[model samples]
Target: MDMDNFREMFLTEAAEHLQLMVDLLVQLDSDPQDQDGIDALFRGAHSIKGMAASMEYPETARLAHHLEDHLADCRQLGQISGVEIDWLLEAVDLLELLLGDIRNGRPERNVDSFIAGISKQPEAAVDCVAETKTVELTACGRGQLIQLQLQESVAIPGPRFLVLLKKLADLGTILESTPSTEDLLQGDAPNQLLVRL
Candidate 1:
C-alpha cells in the first residue's frame, strides 16, 4: 500500500484506540480497581504510540508515549484517582484534537508543553517496590529471573531501564520482561524492573 493508504489506516485505528481509552478511563473513574480496564487503556496507548511512530507522526507518538507511561503508573497503583482521571480525560481530548488535525491534513500540534506539565504534577510513590529486590536462578527454565529496584533518587528510570536492558543484552539474550521492551522505550518509568535472561 502507498503512504496515503497507510496514513488512513493509522488514523482509523488511532481513533478507535482513543475511543477505547476514553471509555476505559471513564470506567476507571467509577471503579478504580478495574485492572483489566487499566490494562486495556495501556494497550490502547501503546498501540497508538507504535502506530504513530511507524507513521512518523512525532507529536502523536510523543503524546501517546506520555499517555502510555501515565497508564503504567495507574496500573502500578492498582487504582486511579479522580484528579488523575480528569487529567487523562483532558489529555485524551487533546489527542482527539490532534487526530482531527491529522485527518484534515493540517500541521501536527506541539504537545511538548502538555507533556512537560505531566512531569510537574506530583508523582506517585512506589517506595514499597523500591525497597525490595528479587532474583531467581532457574537451571531448568529458559533463563534466570532478576528483579532490579530503582532508587527514588533516580529522576528518569525509563531511560535507565533501557540502558540496563542494552547492557544485559551484551551478556545474554533476554527471555522476557514484566512491562516489556516497548513500554520501557515509551518511557514507562517503573520503580522496579523484572527481567528473565
Candidate 2:
C-alpha cells in the first residue's frame, strides 16, 4: 500500500495546512467576521485532519480536528475573541511541533496532554455541519510547500522512477519548481531536490 509514501505525503500536506491555518487565523483575528476566511480555515483544518487520520497519524489528525471545531464555533457564534485567536494560533504551532515528531519516526511523542486541555472547553466543542467532504489536500497545493531531501542512494535517472511526474502533473498544475531536472539530471542539485507543486 506504499505506507512510507503515504506517510511522506501526509507529513508534507499537514505541514502546509498547518501554516494555512496560522495565516487564516491571523486574518480572521483582524476582521473577526470574514466568512470566507473562516471557511478557508475550516477547509484547511479538515483536509489535514482527514489525511493524517488515513496515514494513522492520530496526533496530527486530532489536533486538526480540534482546530476545526474551534473555528466552527466562531462561525456559528459570529465573533472571535482575542483569547480565542491566541488559543487557535498556539494550537497550530503545537501541531507543527508534533508534525515534526511524526516525520522523525517519533509518533509516540506525548501530545494528548495539550489536546486534552483544549478539548475540555465548551466553546471548542461547537458542532460542525454534517457533510460528506472528500476534497483533501494533496502533496501539492498553494501555501503547502515541501522540501524534498531525497535519499543519497536513490538512482539519478528518469528511469530511476517509473515515470510518475506525468501523472502528478495531470492531477494539478505545477505552480513552481526548482533544482531543475537538468540540474538533478546532471547531478547539480546533489539530490536535495526542492519543489513546490
Candidate 3:
C-alpha cells in the first residue's frame, strides 16, 4: 500500500481505538477496580502511541504517550477514580480532535495545554479546556465584515470557529465577533459566525 493508503488505514484504526477507549472509560467510571478494563485502557493508549509514531505524527504520538503513562500509573495503583476517568475521557476528546486534524491533512492542533494538564493532578486536568488566547483589538474603524457558516456535517464548530478567527487575525485585526472569543473558548457551538476584520 502507498502512503495515502497507510494514512487512511491509520485514521480508521486510530478512530476505532479512541472509541474503544471512551467505552472502556465509561465502564471504568462505574467500576474503578475493574482490572481488565484498566488493562484495556492502557493497551488502547499504547496502541495509538505506536501507530501514530509509525505514521510520523509526533503530536499524536506524544499525547498518546502521556495517556499511556497515566494509565500505567493507574494500573500500578490497582484502581482508578471517577475524577481520573473524567480527565481521561477529556483526553480522548482531544485525541479525537487530533485525529480529525490528521484526516483533514491539516497541521495538528496545539496539545501542549492538554499535555501539561495531564502531567498535573486530576483536579487540574480541566485547565486544558480553558485556552489563554486573547483577541487582538485594533483602532475602531470600518473593516471588511466576513461571515462564516460551518457545514451541517461538522461535528464540532467551536474549535473550527476559533481556528478561523486565528487565521483571520493573522491577515488583519478583528474589530468584533459574534458569540465573542470568550464564548467560543467556553464551548459555544454557533453554526454561523460573523467577524469584522
List the candidate 2 regions with Cα displacement exceeding 4 Å: 119-197
Segments in model 1 whose C-alpha atoms lie over 4 Å from true places: 122-197
lDDT of 1 by residue, 30-128 (tens): 588899999999999999999999988899999999999998998999888755765676577678778888889999989988898886653532322
lDDT of 2 at 168: 31
- TM-score for each of the candidates: 0.60, 0.57, 0.63
Best by lDDT: 3
Clashing pairs in 3: none
Each prediction's whole-model lDDT (CA): 0.76, 0.59, 0.78
lDDT computed for candidate 3 = 0.78
Clashes of each: 0, 0, 0
Better model by TM-score, 1 or 3?
3
Candidate 3 weakest ten by summed lDDT: 125-134
Off-target runs (Cα >4 Å) in candidate 3 are 122-197
Return the top candidate by TM-score.
3
Candidate 1's C-alpha lDDT?
Answer: 0.76
